[model samples]
Target: MTGIPKTYQRIVLAARPRGPVAPENFRLETLDVPELADGEVLIRNHYLSLDPYMRGRMSSAKSYASSQPLDQTMIGGTAGQVVASRNDYYRVGEFVGGMLGWADMGVSDGVLLRKLDTTRIPLSTYLGVVGMPGMAAWYGFNQILEAGAGDTVVVSAAAGAVGSVVGQLARLRGCRVVGIAGGPEKCEYVVKQLGFHACVDYKAGNLEADLAAATPDGVDAIFENVGGACLDASLARTNAFARVALCGLIAGFNGQEMPIKNSRLLLLNRVTLRGFIITEHMEFWQQGLQELAVLVANHQIKYRETVAEGLAAAPQAFMGLLQGHNFGKQLVKLI
Candidate 1:
């Protein structure tokens, strides 16, 4: 609390994007910090998470979550330290995770924020492997796909936060895992470092052929992250009774239309496709968090991150994430 400041800088939604989001869509503002009332806690954010789902929140379209209001602090996940506190539960100098948005500092009433133990793992890990993205891969892989050993599993956007975990979990379950990433570097990292059985570079202009070659036995489980060509290619290679966990549609995030042309493949293959958001299944949170933390702790899972240096770089970093420019998890370091 000794070095805590009285004001902070934050980014707000200045305008909705007409197509792909740009830096002009956001505005930065400096403001006086609010005095903490009884039961309120002040947080000084250390890391801000950049995710693909955020693109949907920018548009005023029907989505599982409500649209982000204009001129408001842009919505985000943050890991930070409690700089000051009047709340009985949270203490000063303790780390916490919350939806504190794109702010250098924030105040909360101890509602959504959760205390974190930064002693064991890197504090930023809470924003990636041990956070929402990890929970997403956990639920999608275990609950939705119910993948079994010896199954041929395929995951798109395989180098990303959720996709990387999905591939690793599937491989750990004794499945032959194949990943689809954007470039040769990511593909190499996916197969060599992450231990996926194979990785296809979708940007190589051989998606259908490469995927077909990779999953020669046909895909038993598909974790669909990028929707357009990747989903289409996976659908074409599905075995009967295949399970498809539809995650993020990063391919069409810039307002491109996503239409399924392989209708016959689904009926012929008897595939099961389920789109899920981790927030909807609160019952699985405890189990998922425990398993994810354990895997991370034991080194059974590997993760990577592309860190943006500061809050001002968040907008551009996020834009890069949408284009598959990030090698792994995209994050903004605010400290």
Candidate 2:
């Protein structure tokens, strides 16, 4: 490959967090680009996705997936262009999305890579709305929630990547959507920008009352992202036979105990709650991505992003994301 850099920078997981993740948990290192194997592909990562799931991966505690190995490039999704290829299936100059981790560049054997089409959707979106986050929204709404016309759907962390999509999708399905976000700005964006019916500011110190006022008909479906108070408030407003898709528990991600205060409502209201990991259902990804791509390309589905420039900013950007400082999808522009 002509003009390929001899060395690249990558962020490695230097230490496991005892509680909240800090900058010290990651270490930046420079390494020589590895020689590609007979069936390998070299990728120059343009963007690295910063997701809440990566927080769980940082812990050694029992989880659905293995803990991220220490001193290794921190695991993450990336969108990039192939700089070199030794495989027939993928060619140099092709755009791709893969688990390339937090690096300026990486090498893969072509097994984990998926070719991307950036004609309509931007390449960075493949790591966002038309990618895993979008898939999670689609699958959770359509399969788990099973919401329909006249249903009141409440989405926690509604201004974020997955929650934003979930609310929009529910609205498209003729359901009334209410969003729960951090502050006035995010709440306003949820209602005005994302077209949600109403948005509750969870930071206003009146979550339960505000949520109740917003969801007058009671919440028929919930796409829960932040648990703790958000979940408790939503649970208190659940309608009979209400469906809940528990996608993330960001409120408790920093090792806080966030027990549900309204657990009795599950039995009282006959609520059906299901927690899912999107990776566990890879079969529906293609179908969901196709639908999401079309909607996004047509502008029926709008999304936002908060990008931090350079690979060096990932840890700080990630910390911001955890603290709800980001507007939507958070990414590190590695290029």
The 0-to-1 C-alpha lDDT of every candidate, in the order given, reads 0.92, 0.95
Model 1 Cα lDDT, one tens digit per residue, 1-335: 56778779999999999998999999999998988899999999999999999999999999999999999999999999998999999999899999999999999999999888876778888889999999999999999999989999999999999999999999999999999998899999999999999999989999999999998899999998998889999999999999999988988888899988886898999999999988999899889988888898899999999999989999999999988889778999999
- Compared with the true structure, model 2 gives a TM-score of 0.99
- List pairs with backbone clashes in candidate 2: none
> How large is the C-alpha RMSD of every model relative to the true structure?
0.9, 0.6
lDDT (tens digit, per residue) of candidate 2 on 32-131: 9999989999999999999999999999999999999999999999999999999999998999999989999999998989999999999989988998
Clash number for candidate 1: 0
Best by TM-score: 2
lDDT for predicted candidate 2 compared with the true structure: 0.95
Model 2 spans > 4 angstroms off: none
Which ten-residue region of model 1 has the weakest summed lDDT? Answer: 1-10
Point out where model 1 deviates above 4 Å.
none
